[model samples]
Target: MRLPIVAGWPACTVMNCEADQAGYGEDKCVTHLSEGELGGWLSRLGPEAEIHLARTQLAKGTLDQIKGAVTGQDDVPQFGYLSLRRAEIEGGVDLCYSRFSKEVDLYGLKVSKYLDFEGVQVSGGLDANFIEAPQGVDFYRAKIGGSLNLEGSKVGEQVRVARCDIDGSFLLRGCQVSGNVECYEVKVSGPAYLSNMQVVGDISFRNSSFSDGVQFFYTETSGYFNVSDSEFSGFVEFEGLRIAHDLIWERASFRDDVTFDKADLSGLVQGSCLFYKGVNFIRTIFRSAVIIQACARRVDFWGARFEVGGTLLLRYAMVRMTGAILAGPTSLVAFNRNFVDIFGDPMDEFVIPHEDPNVKLLDMGSVNAGNLTLVDIDLTPCRFAGAFNLDQLRLEGEWNFGTPPSGRVGITPFTWAKRKIIEEERQWRALRSHPLVLRSGWGDPPDNPRDVPGVAALMTTYRQLRKGREDAKDEPGANDFYYGEMEMRRHNQSWGKGERWLLQFYWLLSGYGIRASRAFGWLIISMILTILLMMGFGLPQDSPKQEAAGTVPPGGGKVTFEIDKEDPRNPIGDRFTSKRFERALNVTLNSVVFHSSDQDLTTTGTYIEMASRFSEPVLLGLGILAIRGRLKRGS
Candidate 1:
């Protein structure tokens, strides 16, 4: 028979045969050799010799003869170099417990059934790119010294690389697997490039460890993309990755930064991951819920979009969300795990804390708050500038805002009264440029320039937050925000303007109608001043007397009596008499309630009563307004 031509090796000595010599210096290929010659050729096989099976069809039992020739001590098949490029395996390839000192070249090789490499150890890399495996490929418990490349390969069934320890990079780029790709407990010393891969079934690296990181850029998987319990030591990139189902990463730890930029997930991206560094989800799109219960340093969702009815639960996660966009009706929760998992499911693992794993920073600078719900999350470090539809934002449960400075600051008389104010207001007031702010001991200004919101922006933020609190029937909480809003407006206006002066007076009198004690104190002071003024200059020196005169000539039948009273003069002396003090006290008390007292008074005392009627009543009204604000409930 005319055999196929194999390049880069001596051809078989059989006439018109171009098959490569099976053994070194062999006269014929494996197909052309007789039983006696094949036995002699197999006897000469050693572990140091290269094996070229390229472009040749291997019979069912031929591998048994080849395996026996290369079997070393302990009955393990050993080879220096093995090439099966473009070769067809009739009975499939099973190199179980095989040891290869050099590379294994399976380029363009065709295996009709499963190819087993169970317990195999390869010193050199495996170049199985573009190989055709109709059944499956197994490298279970295999130890590879170099890279395990399967680029552009088509596996009809599952590809098991579980328990594999790879020294070099593990590349499956552009490979298509019709079945599951199992990579459980695998360890990779080099980078793992899984880009452009398409898997019909699940591709898992569960419990795997990657020392040089991994990439899944543009990879599309129909099933779940799970890296649960895996550890990544280097940077990981999953940009443009598409998952038809959920992306689970429960209990996974990432030592380096990770990015999922521009990724599309049809299902949820749920995880209990621990990231020591940062993670980015820039421009990513999620169709379902994103429930990440991770303890990450920072997690950026910049420009990411979510679908409707999706929930973003970050229970027990110490993460900071930056530039995230909640475009749809998304329920966001970042409460403590105990607060969320109150049902006490047995399967839920209790986390041991290095620190409290709760959200510390939430940057809502680029978020759309239209259909977002924030529940029980700390907003002490939250930034809300450039947020859209903030008035429609829903705040549920006890949302915590930035608290004012507690206790007395230094020996100064100024102390920041307790109030829940937004972070922007604190940042603005903490600026060194404002002497009053410094005197109030607002601490340091924000280190980031972007955090310092303008007066107008802070006003808008406070107004929107106040509206949200009012909508939620939290009048007490909204009162603080209202005070902040008015403060911002006052700060924004020029001191010479009437609006600023009016606000200043309002703040001084009643703390924008929220401080009942301050308003009442002002009212008491006004009453005391009025009493002293009335006692000093508002009482007459003596009581005015009336005289009656009758006109008898014009009307004899009726006596016409005219009562004449002299205008009282200003007080000359002894205005502090007991009788004068009683009249002054009576007049001042009536004017406090906008009532006029029927008492005789000097001209100066009359003017004083008119002023008291206007001013004392106003102060009393202000006190009442302050009380109403403190106790007002939502209607």
Candidate 2:
């Protein structure tokens, strides 16, 4: 029913309400309408009509009895400006699908029930400062053209802004959410500030996009907080955050720097994200597990601390940074299948697979922990590109590498064949390469002197580790890593020509002091060869004429005297006839054993004897040292 319009007076079309006394317009009216009356009035306005509340306030005084301000679904009501400052909403406020043409000011308002703004389109900014919602607040799928300011608000239940698009800055500083706070799939155009927020339940920003900077400084969350799959185009700061439950940021991308300095996470902190710029986790503490699957660019964990409740896993992560500091005693499991690139140059045409495929590059140079358990890790394939500062590291438990669950697998015949084939292919390719050929491949081979950083790092780490083991009286461990250090030195292409030759010579002679038995083997082979030479040449055929002389000749000659039973020197020994082969064998044995035999040594035999005397003692000494080392290790 249309209301009558009198001269200079107009009433609400449905009700006999007088026009807004503030003289907003004939069509606008401020009434203390019931929910039914308001719903009917809004329904009558239809989609084409614009609700102009300029200079007019539609105040609901007894709204406590109403179930909802707008309950039933009608076409979205178009409002010029929404000003509900200091208004008290006893029940829920559903502004779903509502389109506000201008700014929305709900400052200092209190809602006893849920406050929903689902699918709402606000052309101007949204200001909900100091707003209190006891039930919950939702802005699901809402599109805000201007900034969304919800500073100093307190929500009893969850605050969901899932799938919302805010064209302007989103501010929720000093807000308190009693329940979960979800901002999943939200796209914010400007800076988003949620500093000092207190969320009792989980908080999520999954799949959201923050074009400008985002800050969550000093924010506290009792339950899980996730920003998984979110994209931050600008700087993201989460300094001084306190999370009681797990904090996850799996697959998130940050275009600029992200800082999480001084954060205290009581539960697991998992991140498998990408950071184009630098990232900092300085002084952060994780009470439970802290896993970082992957990250790009610099990542600084200068003073981060982790508790022992769970393992700190850094699987498949690539971090290009100066270093990461581990300051506490914890179990660190760093497994990266993709870490094979560190073993070789990424720009090389051919890359040799790492000694272990499961090797991970851990920059433990800045680690300051006393006791750390490094399990299922192999340092052989690691490329420590910088100074491995282990001066302050006090490794407590067994420094496990090539051991247990993730240890190297025994290669089967088929596996070996496959590897050989691959190696042959690489060798063939290398043979055809020109010295000036550009290295354009995925493998990182050491092509220049600058590429020796990994070798230097390995050398430093191995030396330090060996020293630590030696100090602890772990002879076996020390010896094991001693070989590792030698291997690094041997493979270092940056060594000078003389140094390389010396290393190769040492390896050939004594296997770098580890395989003394090899030297002993060579000594035996030399003795055998000498024996054959002496037998074949017959030891210069000692002159027979010299035997007749009364004086002994300088080149001693064989004395063949007639055997007479009357001769006392001959006695019965002359009855035992020996072959020439026997005589030569005896002489050779005497020469090698450094013993004087009755047979005279000829000039050629003298040379063989002198060579054996020189080499035998050296070989024996090496064997003794090897045995000593083995005994010390066993002990």
- By lDDT, who's the top model here? 1
Residue 9 lDDT, candidate 1, scale 0-100:
81
The lDDT for every candidate, in the order shown, is: 0.79, 0.61
lDDT score for candidate 1 against the true structure: 0.79
What lDDT tens digits, residue by residue, belong to model 1 across residues 1-635? 01122346876777886656786657577877778888888888976557887666778878778888898778889988887877777867998989998888888788788789999999988888888887889999999988888888899889899999999989888889999888999999999999999999988989999999789999999999989879899999999999999998877878899999999999876656767777877888887766655556677777787764466555444344455666567766764553222244322334334555555546777677887787777788778888877888888776788887776766766466567877778777777676763536566777875658799988998899889878877787788889888988998999889999999998888788787777788878877777788888777666777989887775458778999987766687676778767777788889999999977777777888899899878878877876776687878
Q: Which tens-of-lDDT digit does each residue in 394-462 have in candidate 2?
A: 444333343111222233221111100111122222332424232222133435533344455566666
User: How many Å off is the CA of 167 in candidate 1?
Assistant: 3.9
